[model samples]
Target: MTVTDGVQRVLAELQRFGIDRQDVIVSTNVRTRLDGLPRSGEREPADSGAAVYWQERTGARRVIAIDHYIKVADNLAAIAATLDAMRSIERHGGARILERAFTGFTALPGATAPSWRDVFGVPPDCHDMAVVRAAYRRRASSAHPDKGGSNDEMATLNAALRDASTELGKPIGGEGS
Candidate 1:
């Protein structure tokens, strides 16, 4: 199918999930002619991506983005393949949305560091220092050098604990003031 057809299908699918067209954002790199007009069809190469932004009745704005179709040679093929994948997802079950705030060092470009919450395997809303420390200890058991883990792994756990504790305004080894 053509790129336009793929886009239309995507919009229709989102509508089925109660997401309004106004709440969705479509994006793509458009190939242009010498006269500065967008190329009409999928013949040209461009990177295509889109995001559906939505909010629960009393929740923060959240997004489900599909931007990984870069392997396709041209924008048209990329969007077509993406539509097929979305349809497959619908066939099985709808996409599951997870909420997490990408923060601090994790937000930087090319930074592979996991967020504190990710390192501790805790949900974003779990901010109690006691819970974070318990998570740290649980992970530390497997990350400590004596337990067949490398120094780097243990160091990452330590850093994760420090960052999380600081963000929570709690002392690392003592009760909060």
Candidate 2:
């Protein structure tokens, strides 16, 4: 399919997730420096392609830039993969998913760090070590690697536990104690 066709497909997929076409911007004219450095005016044309930018209603924006000089098929494939991921996030997490998907960081919006309180399902002011340990144990039981869970999940749990311990001033697993 043509680049325009690919763009239309992406836009249509985003629209299905309640994103408006007007909130999407497609640009085919982009220039870059040849020396791989940022330059001011009149840089060389990189490729014959387009960049698709979508801004969600909640102010999260993502840009997908494709360079068609390599292969149009590859570009189209990338677009398809991105659309599939976006659809999955929207289906599972709704519009709030856009913030995490576009930001490259899993922290909540306007927050510099991911909250251990949120991960452990505790109140922000909760400082009791017993409460933190109880929450950690419950989460660890379900997220343990041997219980059909992933190593990544276990690692995340460990990190959250450490953070929660530190936040509560009760060091566990030999961290900050």
Candidate 3:
């Protein structure tokens, strides 16, 4: 599908959810010449993703975005695929998808920090700060430099503890055993 056609499909899907065209924003990196032609001998950038954002009727802002297109090289084609995914999401009740798109985990390019659960060796849904603290102390005992652990291990443990503390809305500082 052409980029324009993909954009139109996304807008129509948004409209089905009571989102007005004016209230929705569509974004992509594809740019066309004023005469609607690609420049001669010039290749477009390799960015092939798009994002759609709108404010829900409940005053909550939501977004559906895709920045990765596996095995897709052409920008327009990638954008078209991403838009198709967006429409499919909305058609199949996209509340969870929309929420996750807006507030999902983000990592720096080429560098991913370990998740709090992995660092603490806890279950994914472990949210109790007490459990977190206990895990931290237990890990710290083995990770501390004085206990045959390296500075890097201790640092990783401390960083994980701080992340969990903040996520659980607890105070930053805590005694580790």
Q: Which candidate's TM-score is highest?
A: 2
lDDT string for model 1 (47-129, tens) is: 45544445534545655556666522233345445556766776675554211233444557897777889999989888799
Estimate TM-scores for all models: 0.38, 0.39, 0.37
Per-residue lDDT over 1-177 for candidate 3, one digit per residue giving the tens place of the 0 to 100 score: 455655666666667667887787666555545643232233434765566777878888887666666211234345445556766776787967766764444444655678888998889777788898888899889889999898989878887888888887787555432
For candidate 1, the 10 contiguous residues with the lowest summed lDDT are: 96-105
Ordered list by TM-score, greatest first: 2, 1, 3
Give the C-alpha miss distance for residue 149 in model 3, angstroms: 28
Those runs of model 1 whose alpha carbons end farther than 4 Å from true positions after fitting are 1-108
Give the alpha carbon lDDT tens digit for every residue of 11-102 in model 2: 67778868887787665543334532222333334454556677988898988876755544346446656787868876788668566575
**Number of the top candidate by lDDT?**
3
Q: How far is candidate 3 from the true structure (C-alpha RMSD, Å)?
A: 12.7
Which ten contiguous residues of candidate 3 have the minimum total lDDT? 35-44
User: Which is the better candidate, 1 or 2, if ranked by lDDT?
Assistant: 2
Provide the overall lDDT of each model, using Cα atoms, as 2-decimal numbers: 0.64, 0.66, 0.67
For model 1, the local distance difference test gives 0.64
